[model samples]
Target chain A: MKEIATYVERTFESVPDSQRKSEIMQEIIERLEDSAGKLEQDGKAREDAINKAIVDFGNLDEILQELRGQETGKGKALSSLWFAVIGSLLVIALTVFINLYYSPGVVWFLYPTFAVIWWPLCIFFFGKWRKGR
Target chain B: MVSSDLLRGHLETILLRLIGETDRYGYELFSEIDGRAGGRLVVKEATLYAVLQRLERQGYITSYQGDVSGGSKRRYYHMTPLGKANLEQGIREWHEAQEIINIFLRGNIQ
Candidate 1:
């Protein structure tokens, strides 16, 4: 059992630290111990049971790739939305500054501001659609 | 042995159905699948956990830690209402696919 726990911890060493990572590791170790115990109960030698249990757990790389893929996908979508939002804000700020400096009597920045708002709105909807996919 | 690729699409439904039957821990779920398949199909633990995580994230399932003998705890997964609804839809689609595939396999296509 200690061997199984150590094996799980070592395997997770390459994974970036996070609450999710620790939870996954804990769950995996418990499952491996359960499997090893059952194999031992089936009359296999303890060493053999532990080895078989580890083998049957399969490659951690595949799981890591999956986890990374999900994280990257989510990050990309969120970052893109943030980029749109920041870009829109910058554009609006520039427009407001020009309007205030050049045409202090006219208030026309609101028109361009409406158009700028659509940038983040579109990106937000796109992010939602991508996530649904 | 069943190809993992072929099983991948239905794996979620299979898991949902299993969990819908009763709450089970990770190891117990895998053992049930292995037993039901009679060793003809084996789902890698990595893949199983990934699918389980996806299901939980999608709000189709929830998990809680349950105490077992020997003072140990196990994370047990339970299907939610959304999962039951999804399972029903999955079964409907599966039946439809089966019926269509049978037309070709049985040479009944006109």
Candidate 2:
């Protein structure tokens, strides 16, 4: 099963480090091992069983692409939230500048600031709900 | 061999039905699929895992580590109520699709 372990490791080498990645790797290795064991029980030699198991496991690239896509999806969501936050901050900054520069006495920036704050808050809560789902 | 493209869409339902039958580990599930397909279908390992992960993420199934004979643990997957409901719905849809396709195939365009 050393070969199987090595194959799984090499296949997952490019996957971003995550707890889920490690768990998946372990699961794949165990599955391959189990398959090879079954083949050995069916009268195949250890080496032949291992080789056949690996061959039957099929391409890993497809799996890698999926895992990478999932990670990228998560990263995209987080980056979008950050973008919203930065955008809201910039908007608030502009409002503050306009208020301070034009009419600091009235102080009407708080209304826009309150409205802008909700953008990131909505995204943050949506993200949390999505993750929980 | 059956084209994977044809089987891809129904793979989720098939797996859910299998898991619904009983809790199965990865190897057992793969082997069962292969055996049931009778060598007519070739399910790639990557495809199976991808579907499994997707189903898990969708709350259709849950997994746990199970003790095996060799002092090793295997991850077994069990279907949830949501999965069972989905499976039933899939079966209904499949039957509807089959009937519609059969009508077309049979040249009963009316």
Candidate 3:
């Protein structure tokens, strides 16, 4: 277990962003500790449990996969929500500008214009976000 | 004896059904499957975890860390409401597919 922790820490040290690496390492350690404790409870010696866990988790692919899933979901939600709000604001601005320059009746077109513009903007950002993820 | 593919469907259904009943960590889930399958079906640890991860990613289930005791903290998985709907759909689909295959296998001409 200690060796596993050390290995994770060492890998994290090489990462440029401290915060992200820490978050990733924490989850990796959490999983390793859980597995090691299980093996110990099943009657294996402490050292044996540690050895087995480190050996089984020789590569960090599974841990990386979990982190990737979490990051993608968070990234997608954040991008979509922010873009939707910005797109709505842009549409409102355009509607106000048109109303000011010409006639106030343009205000009635606000909702329809917003929908027409927002849907495609939303879809574009959504597609881009999904692909980036 | 059920074919491997059929058995895989049974495994997914059994796991989803058991998690629906109660949130359980991996080990407990394994025992439940063993009990329900009457020792006829057992999932490999790797395969079970892989499935659990996929189900979770699909929003069919959710999991969280439970109490730590004597050093080990278990992460328990539970089916979401969406999981219930998904399970039902999967069951219906499997039944339909099985019917089609079974008819051909049995040579039951109508």
Candidate 4:
């Protein structure tokens, strides 16, 4: 049961921290314990019951897919990628508008946009990646 | 036994039926479903969560925290009034499908 709890918690590790997410994590853990308990009553060894319960719950990827479908939080990696893309487009448009209006004679827009966009993005991505662990 | 793919489409109806008589917690509801199917069919816990979430989202059911079990609280689901109407429609469709399939199975005997 303890192992199952740990495994279930680890399975939910990537879910953005939230009250509902934690509740579901606890629900999953409780369900696993109930499952294992029933198997034990049916004459299975403790370890075997735990193993079967975990296996019956399905794999992490499948669980994640199911969770992502229900969880409105969205995936951090995917959200970050979208942010990067949209930010780039906005920056590019700004750069062109700035260049065309000011006639800098060069695409010096890249330099400022690079700093303006990339720094925040770099910091954001690094923070996200670090927090993911 | 129904394939999981087929089961996916009917899960909402199945859940509605299961909750019709008595509200039940996630584990109990799923275990009863598996048992009533004579072990020929079983729903993965993860998939069940997604279905339950969808049902709740659609206002077909509502969930509430229940007494603790195994050191954690349980989530019990109850069918909404709208769910009862949905269930009736689903059963009607099911009966129609069953009759049509039976007729096909019987072939041009008439």
Query: Candidate 2 — which residues are off by over 4 angstroms?
Result: A34-52, A65-71, A78-82, A85-133, B107-110
* Each prediction's whole-model lDDT (CA): 0.87, 0.87, 0.71, 0.79
Q: Kindly list the per-residue Cα lDDT of model 1 for residues A1-133, writing each as its tens digit.
A: 7998898888778777877778888778877888899999999999999999888888777666555665677778889889999999999999999999999999999999999999999999988887788
lDDT at A113, model 2: 96
Alpha carbon deviation, residue A130, candidate 2 (Å): 21
Task: Give the alpha carbon lDDT tens digit for every residue of B1-110 in model 1.
Answer: 98989878999999999999999888788889999999888799878998888888788999998887566677889999999999999999999999998887976557
Residues B10-109 of candidate 4 have per-residue lDDT tens digits of 8889989998889988777778988999888868877777677778767899989888665666788999999999999999988898899898796676
Ranking by lDDT: 2, 1, 4, 3
| Native contacts conserved, per model | 0.62, 0.66, 0.00, 0.52
lDDT of 3 by residue, B12-92 (tens): 666798898889887678667768778776555445665676678778898887898557667789899999998898789
Sorted by DockQ, highest first, which candidate order results? 1, 2, 4, 3
True-vs-predicted CA distance for residue A70, candidate 1, Å: 7.1
Ten residues in a row with the worst lDDT in model 4 chain A? A65-74
User: In model 4, which runs have C-alpha deviations exceeding 4 angstroms?
Assistant: A38-46, A60-63, A70-133, B68-72, B108-110
TM-score per candidate, chains pooled: 0.71, 0.70, 0.50, 0.64
Off by over 4 Å in 1: A1-3, A14-20, A34-50, A65-72, A85-89, A92-133, B108-110
The number of clashing residue pairs in each candidate reads 0, 0, 0, 0
Q: For candidate 3, lDDT tens digit of each residue in A7-66?
A: 678755533544434644665576667789999999999989987876665555444455
Q: Give one digit per residue, the lDDT tens place, for model 2 in B1-110.
A: 98999878999999999999999887678889889889788897867888888888778999887887566677789999999999999999999999998877976557
User: What is the alpha-carbon lDDT for the whole of candidate 3?
Assistant: 0.71
Candidate 4 per-residue lDDT over residues A43-67, each given as its tens digit: 9999999999888886556545555
DockQ for every model comes to 0.41, 0.39, 0.10, 0.31
Find the 10 residues in a row with the least total lDDT in model 2 chain B: B65-74
- Chain A TM-score for each of the predictions: 0.52, 0.53, 0.41, 0.52
